[model samples]
Target: MESRQRALVLHRLPYRETSLLLDLFTEQQGRIRLVALGARRRRSTLQGCLQVFTPLQIQWRGTGGTLQTLRQAEALSLSLPLTGRALYSALYINELLCRLLVPDVSYEALFGQYLQTLCQLAASDGQYEPILRCFEFALLQALGYGVDFQRCAATGTLVQDQVHYRYQAEYGFVTAAVASQDSFSGQQLRALAAGQLSDAATLRAAKIFSRLAFKPYLGARPLKSRELFY
Candidate 1:
């Protein structure tokens, strides 16, 4: 018997000559692999609906373990197109989710944030740097690696404007008389604390900080999609 669900296609790869193997982020199932049989044939409805970044309602069967077969899929929203840098950024987000999020885990809030981020990136006129940073922070929080930006991780003092600090992956941010060479500016840290996502400089700094913070969790394997941005 097949169960119906909503999912976003994070990644898809060709299987044999006509089918596809899809890595999907679902509302209830988290991440799962679905086989789309004969999807590559010309004029196939599944071919058009199963593209990455597209939102769809999918039906599949096979015990929710591995290699389940998709039974039916229908589009849930208008297609959002992402090009150039936005395209690469979308790919990076997908890669991050694919690598970090485990199968069968329920991350509904993070899933919603992921969808929102993709829509924002596709809009073009909006500033996406902040959206991306916010999504990254939310992802970390969902995965139980949230940082404490409201106060010093060391002395428990409220983070002040004049204090220099260094962020450690396991310990959040700590005040240091001699700050790390790569530490972000006080203004940047303040902006992050306030959840202000409009400043380009702050967004840039936050991205670097997020990369450092995610390193230990990511292990030695590099995110392949990140290379497209360089």
Candidate 2:
């Protein structure tokens, strides 16, 4: 049977001689690996359309195996013109998705959110923190590891506006005996919960929280896209 869906090339690599292997995020199939036969050939039309961040309508066919063969791919639109920090941010999002998403499972809402994030990145003037934080939080929720900002997961106590807490990845936020430099205030957590990056402090807190939330799933390897920042 053949399957067709809307997709974005999350990553691609050279395959053998004139072929390419693609990691695609599809609306209907989530993350899938496809082998694009002869895509790297000089005369192949697919060489131009098989690009990262480009919207595509793809068709593939396979059985129960993990890999599929690409039957067709057509560009739905022009590739997004993301550059500078926005470009790096987009790469980070792609690499993060490739690392965390389970294969073959449908993430329809997340696919929409990913497209929206790309559009936001294309339109922004380099203030990417809030955009990234929101996407990261949404991805966590989609993965069933979302953090509860309104209450301590350990104690079930309401998060007070004045109290400070420290994040424990396995257990969520807990009351801290001392307000260390790394601690997050209840106000900041609440602001994040409300989708408000109202101040520099709150923005900083969101970045820290996202890092902590993703640490366990991401394991020990550093994300290649992150190095582009420095």
The whole-model C-alpha lDDT of candidate 2 against the native structure comes to 0.93
Q: For candidate 2, lDDT tens digit of each residue in 1-230?
A: 78999999999999999999999999978899999999999999999999999999999998535578999999999999999999999999999999999998889999999999999999998789889989999999989889889898778988999999999996789998989877899999899889999689999999999998899999999999999999
Estimated TM-score for each candidate: 0.91, 0.98
Tens digit per residue, CA lDDT, model 1, 133-230: 88899999999998878678878877877777788888888776775556765666888878886766777778888988899989999999878867
Cα-based lDDT at residue 218, candidate 1: 90
Candidate 2 Cα deviation (angstroms), residue 72: 0.4
lDDT at position 26, candidate 1: 91
Which stretches of candidate 1 lie above 4 Å from their native place? 185-187
Give the CA lDDT, 0 to 100, for residue 209 in model 1. Answer: 86
lDDT of candidates 1 onward, in order: 0.85, 0.93
